[model samples]
Target: MRVLLVDDEHELVCALAERLGFRGVRADYAVSAEQALELARTTAYDIAVLDVKMPGMGGLELHQRLRELQPDLPAVFLTGHGSELDFAAGAARGEAYLVKPVGIEVLLETFARIAGPWDGQGGRQP
Candidate 1:
């Protein structure tokens, strides 16, 4: 499945995207909310993995905008802070939330749980 990964930490997002590619998932990344929005407008991403605390627009707001663009798109939030408040807020919004430094396996598993199984055949399984 295709993924949109957004984070202010450019290096971290790039590394994660690379790792995801190695695992047979295609990922497009953006370092800012605006960039993510632009990518979302042009790309049909199946899921979005967003960093919670970005510089201009936080993940929550970005998710709102993305949902406007693609109402059924699934999103997962990642935060280095691991704040209970943030976790609760994300949960309240019915989003999949993960702490930063998350294992790729864990992230992929979460994606499968939320977005359905990735069949390893270039698309999600029904």
Candidate 2:
């Protein structure tokens, strides 16, 4: 499925995008919340993968803004920190939260579980 990956760590986001491409998943990335928002406005992504702690807007806030842009879009939060507090906060939002250094397989599985199977056309199938 088409994914919008947003993180302040440019290298990490780009690497993740490249890896996703290798798995046959189309992914676009943004290094900032503003950039993510702009891309969200312009492109139709099946889901978004956002860093919980970002420079300007955090993932939760970014998710809210993105939902405003595409109400049906799903989100997954990624963070380096794995604290109970952070986990609870993310869980409270009712979206998948994955720790950093996640395996590619786990990421792909999570995407499938959340957004369903990719339709091979940059979208998800029902």
Candidate 3:
């Protein structure tokens, strides 16, 4: 599925994007909320993986803004903080949450669960 990966860490974003690519998942990386918003406006991404703690616009805020643009698309929060409050917020928004340093396999599984079955016919068509 097409995924928008939003994270401030350049290395993490690049690594994740590359790993996703290797798995045949189409992933676009955005370093900031504004860039993600801009990308969302023009592209139809199936899911957004956002970092909960960002410099300017946090993941929750970004999630809200993304909903305004693409309400149907699902968003998953990739956070380092494992707090009840963060989990609650993600749950309330009908979104998934994953901790940092996640294994690529787990990340793929989480994306599959959140984005639904991939037809395997082509690249992240779903």
Candidate 4:
């Protein structure tokens, strides 16, 4: 599956990208909302992993914009703050959210749950 990961934390994004790559997931990353938006426009991704608190656009706004571009795209929000407001907003948007420091197992499980199977390939159906 193709994934676009957006986060301000450069180290975290790199680490997560490496981990996802090792697991056979194609992941491209962006550190800012503008870059994420640009990437979204140019690429077809099955899932978008977005950090809730970003410099400019933030995850919620980014999610909304992304949906405008590709309504069916699934998004997962990751937040270090774990604020109730963020959680509520994410829930309202039908996005699956995870707090920072989330384990690989949890990440994988969440992705699998939201990313439905396409035949026997294990990727999302087009």
Off by over 4 Å in 4: 117-126
Candidates, ranked, lDDT: 2, 1, 3, 4
Candidate 2 local distance difference test against the native: 0.89
lDDT of 1 by residue, 1-126 (tens): 999999999999999998898877889999999999999998898889998899989998999999999898888989888788989987766458888789989998998888778767557766
Best model number under TM-score? 1
Clashes within 3 Å, all models in order = 0, 0, 0, 0
lDDT of 3 by residue, 1-126 (tens): 788999999899988988888777888999999999999999988889999999999998998899899988788888898899988987677467888888888877887787776754325544
TM-scores, all candidates, are 0.93, 0.93, 0.90, 0.89
* Native-structure RMSD, model 2: 1.5
Mind giving the per-residue lDDT tens digits that candidate 4 earns over 1-126?
Answer: 788899999999989988888776778999998888899898888889999899888988898898877788889999998788889987777558888899987887787788854332335557
Q: Which candidate would rank higher by lDDT, 2 or 4? A: 2
Candidate closer to the true structure by TM-score (higher is better), 2 or 4: 2
Against the unseen true structure, what C-alpha lDDT does each candidate score? 0.88, 0.89, 0.86, 0.84
Candidate 3: segments with Cα more than 4 A from true spot = 119-126
Which residue pairs clash in candidate 4? none
Backbone clash pairs in model 2 (N, Cα, C under 3 Å; residues 3+ apart or in different chains), count? 0
Candidate 2: tens digits of C-alpha lDDT, residues 1-126:
889999999999999999898777899999999999999989999889989999879998999999999998888999999999999988777369999898999999999898788765555675
